[model samples]
Target: MRAAGRGGPVTRAAVLSAALAIVDRDGVEGLSMRRLAEAVGRDPMVIYRHVPNKAAVLDGVAEIVFAQLSVDVKDSDWTAQLRVIARDFRALALEHPHVVALLVTRPLATPLGQRPPAVVRPLEDILTLLTQAGFSGETALHIYRALFGFLYGHILNELQEVVERPEETDEVLRLGLHRLPVNEFPLLRELAPLLAHYDGAAELERGLDILLNGLAATL
Candidate 1:
């Protein structure tokens, strides 16, 4: 659906929002100026008036995603605040599974200085958290890399767990992992039951424990 207020002025927010929904229903490749125009009941030129090109639309989409993350680290325990933001990111990725790929891939193409303000806001907030916690500028940058890298990797890994049948009880059966020959994949076969019952939040928390604990000692 187009933004609820698309009937009014041709707002940039509406255009970006419609693009996000398009990306949600159809992957980013499916989003085009013409398609966005159709989604918002406007001409292609009209859509262009709001966003110069598809790349800008995507940048806006990224901003929309990163904006969901809490950057407010002031007057709170650092670890706890980071955990909240990490969990928020995990939820956002799951909600927009298709867009998650763009989240990582887009940054490689866009330079740091040229990135959208909304995209940079979270990093600045993290820097605030790290510096306030006694980390030097260089150390804070390293910590940001370590923390965000793990968070991104975790989201990818978690999403790769294919639940072929949600109602199914058997792990191997649920994921269709039983097709492998028992002799070659013996351990994996044996662990099927345990694997099927994977809890992403619990697993992420365990990883956070190790990562945050190790980082804390550096201060």
Candidate 2:
């Protein structure tokens, strides 16, 4: 549906694209129907014609981001394909850190059948990848769940390592780990140096190694 604006007819894609920009700039909290209408240069009431409400707009924004994740269903090496997908997914999350929360939490709120098609496509494609590689549908589904569960955890963990004092030379000060009592949080304080230099890509590869190796053994 196109909402007639002063400049031209704003397609639903245009409306959602504007919504995505708002989310990318100010995050999910900043997005509202009113702001979206302004972004698209339309009346606030006109937004209702494109999307029913803020929830719908939020879902559309998520779909726009998730659409970037590509799946190679034809890749015969299921494990290798999964590794590539995992890395690509990680890159996508890092590229749009603000959208990471939605990427992780939206599924919990949305039932499988109710989720946006783009959000669900990766799952379907992965299932196809595994099943085509000789795994049963049930097992493929389990692998899919396990892989994504690990990914979600990894991404959230990666994004949470915010450096409080980047300019500080001391690792503890840099990570604000020194704020915790040295005696009480001995282990955490001791690891401050290691924590300060987080290598998200290396960490992701390590996790994929462990997870994929373990999953491979079962097959």
TM-score of each: 0.88, 0.92
Candidate 1 residue lDDT tens string, 23-108:
99998999998998888888789888889999888888887887787777684588888888888898999899888887877766
Quote the positional error of residue 1 for candidate 1 in Å. 12
lDDT of 2 by residue, 1-219 (tens): 233456877777889888777777898899888888888888888778879988788777778788999889999898899999999999888887888988888766888999989999999999999999999999999999999999999999998877999999999899888788898999888887788898899988999999999999986
Q: Backbone collision count in every prediction?
A: 0, 0
Please state every model's RMSD to the true fold in angstroms.
2.4, 2.3
lDDT values, one for every candidate: 0.84, 0.86
The runs of at least 3 residues in candidate 1 whose Cα sits more than 4 Å from the true structure, single-residue gaps closed, are 1-7, 163-169, 181-183
Q: Give the TM-score of candidate 1.
A: 0.88
The TM-score obtained by model 2 is 0.92
Q: Pull out the clashing pairs in model 2.
A: none
